[model samples]
Target: MKAKQIRLATRPNGMPTYETFKWTEETVADPAQGEVVLKSLYASVDPYMRGRMNDRKSYVEPYEVGEVIAGGVIAEVVMTNSTQFEVGDIVIGNLGWATHQIAHEDSLRKIDPSKGPLTNHLGILGMPGITAYFGLLDIGKPAAGETVVVSGAAGAVGTVVGQIAKIVGAKVVGIAGTEEKISYLKHELQFDEVVNYKSENFQEELKAACADGVDVYYDNVGGTVSDAVLRLINKYARIPVCGQIALYNLEKPDLGVRVQPNLLVNSALMKGFIVSDYGAHFEEAITDLAKWLKEGKLQSKETVLEGFEKLPEAFLGLFKGDNIGKYLVKIAEPSE
Candidate 1:
């Protein structure tokens, strides 16, 4: 059978264009013993993928030119040789940018569609969800009644981080870029306050919003907004540096905002972490996330694209902050 795949055609300097990728379909032998043929259902588009597009040293290695771009995907087993899974079973794994994947059964984690939407497995219950869980709880360590601030508050990781902080009894304030997103965070998600970073007086507004000062800053966008937030952090405040999407497109890293010296005066704690680094604690985090999700204490959103061919467009949207939540590409319909 043949499978469609998107491969890196060239390394992108800033914002990637369609020319940077080439999509093609190729035939491959059927699954080998202990392997399954999976039909991808959804693919996640994350900020980290931008780093992988460059040939640079990062928490993860960059994707080589002429290679298939990798990412988390939700799929269904259409054929299997392993006793661990059978035909029509749903699963999630790092299946890259292909409509079909052939791999050992162990490479996929069986998922129960009855638990929730299959797409949730790629969003709230997936890597982005896990990142928010550990990044906020382990790194930020918010206390009850303490003021917690989150940048990129409407994005996948940021939304979860802010809501989780509220569940833990912290006064949550969110920073997003649009009026619609700001309204959603305040009215729908119930954040204590929502600030539009694009506003003319964003800095002054942030100060007025957090009258008591911020105890924990869950930073997803690191630029001028973060620089302003840093000025208001309480002594010994914690900053969990989950991402720097604001500067991901910069050709020179030095041109990005500088925030180190502020940490010195406030005696603050700032740390950069990769969610994969806390793999051993994933079960614990997921257990809590699932409970909160079921109990209505947590909420998730996804901006989905209809076909696998739109993957590049969906990915480029991340850098422009055009997506409202977890950006996902639906490659195929899920099995009933």
Candidate 2:
């Protein structure tokens, strides 16, 4: 089979553009013993992938200049030389940008199509859902009747964080970019309040939304938005620094409002974490998330772009704030 892969052509100086990616076609090698020939069903586009584009050491190593861009993918076992999986098995893994690829059996985990739609593996049942699960519950530790504020509140992880706070009996206030996102966060997700950071009186609205002050702040976007949220946090507030999408494209470190004084005055506890930090408990988190999903206590939303060729467009849309929840590309469906 021939597969097309997107490679990093040039590291972005500011925001990534078409020039940053290069596509190449190649004949896929047959899977060796203990391996499987996989065809991608869907691929995930996430904000964290932006940091991997730059030449810097982070929680994960940066992608090589000419290497294939790889992240989470849901795929079908097209052909298998391994006893671990059959030809029709659905699996999920950290795979390449190619539509079809080869992977060792150990690198992929089978997904039961009976539990949910296959796209769930790329969203709620996958990394983003798992990230929200641990980041909010373990680190943020929201308690009942507490005021829980989430930044980037309508995106994948942020949306789940806000909904989970509601499940924990906390008053949920979500900060998003647009009125549409605010409506989805408030009306659809049932958040107690939703504030648009793009509004003229953003800080004032946020303050009014959290009259009791913030107890658990799930931060997905940092920089000035964080500065505002930090000012309203109550004493002993818990902050989980999940993502700093605001600073991802910047050429240099941001030197804006110093929040150390806010932390000091409020006696707040803030910690930065990569989702892999809780790898040992992923199954536990997924189990609970799946239960909540099945019970209708949670909803997984995604903006899916069709065709593998549109993957770049779908990815670039993340920085543009074009997606409401998880953003992904549906390359193809399994050939059943």
Candidate 3:
């Protein structure tokens, strides 16, 4: 059989362009023993993928030029050789930007579409969800009635981070790029306060919204926005540095604003975390998140792109803050 795939054609200097990727079709072999062939249903586009574009040493290796881009995918088994799975079983796995992939039985996890939208397996119910869960609870540690602030609040991880803070009884405030997104955060997500960082008086507005001082600041888009929030953090406050989207595409470090002295004066605690570091708690977090979702305490939003060819476009939008909630690409239909 033949499968269509998107491959990295070159290393991007800053923002990736269409020339950076090349789409090709190739013949795929059938599944061997203990392996299955998956027809992809949904693929995730996340900020972390940007880090993987550059050929540099990091926690995860970068995608080599001329190689397929790696990402989380929801797929259906069309052929299998393992007793653990059968044809027609829907599963989630770390497959790349491809229309079809072959994986070992152990590489896939069964999915229940009845639990929620199957695409969510690549969004809220997936790695981004786990990132928000562990980053907020374990690192931020919001206390009841305390204030929790999140940057990139309209994006996937930030959206869940704010809602989860509210679930823990903390007053939540969100910072997003557009007014429409700010409204979504306030009206749809029910955040206590929402600020449009693009506004002229963002710093003043943030201070007014967080009168008591931020107790927990979920730093997703770290830069000047993070610097401003840091200055207002109360004593012993916690900052979970989940992502630095603002700095991801930059060729050099942003200069002119320094907030380290404020942290020193406030005795605040700031920590960086990778969700994979807390893999031991994945099942526990997912179990609780599923319950919250079922009981109406948690909600997820997804900006889905149809077709596998749009993966690069979906990914490029992340740096521009162009997506609300989780950004995902639906590649195929979920099997019954």
Top of the candidates by lDDT: 2
* lDDT over C-alpha atoms for residue 279 of model 1: 94
For candidate 3, list the clashing residue pairs, or say none: none
Candidate 3 at 250: error in angstroms?
A: 0.6
lDDT by residue (81-176, candidate 3, tens digit) is 889898899988888789988899887899986888887777777888899999999999999999999999999898899999999999999999
Off by over 4 Å in 2: none
Q: For model 3, give the 10-residue run with minimal summed lDDT.
A: 251-260
* Candidate numbers sorted by lDDT from highest down: 2, 1, 3
Give me the runs in candidate 3 sitting further than 4 Å from their true place.
Answer: none
Q: Write the per-residue lDDT of candidate 1 for residues 2-103, one digit (tens) a residue.
A: 999999999998878889899889885688889988899999988888889888898888899998998889888888888999999988988779998787
Tell me the spans in candidate 1 whose CA falls farther than 4 Å from its real position: 255-258
The superposed Cα distance between candidate 2 and the true structure at residue 254, in angstroms, equals: 0.6
Error (Å) of candidate 3 at residue 207 is 0.9
Each prediction's total of clashing residue pairs, residues at least 3 apart in sequence or on different chains, is 0, 0, 0
| Top-TM-score candidate index | 2
Global lDDT of each candidate: 0.89, 0.92, 0.89
What's the lDDT for residue 46 in model 2?
Answer: 88
Give model 1 RMSD, 1 decimal: 1.4
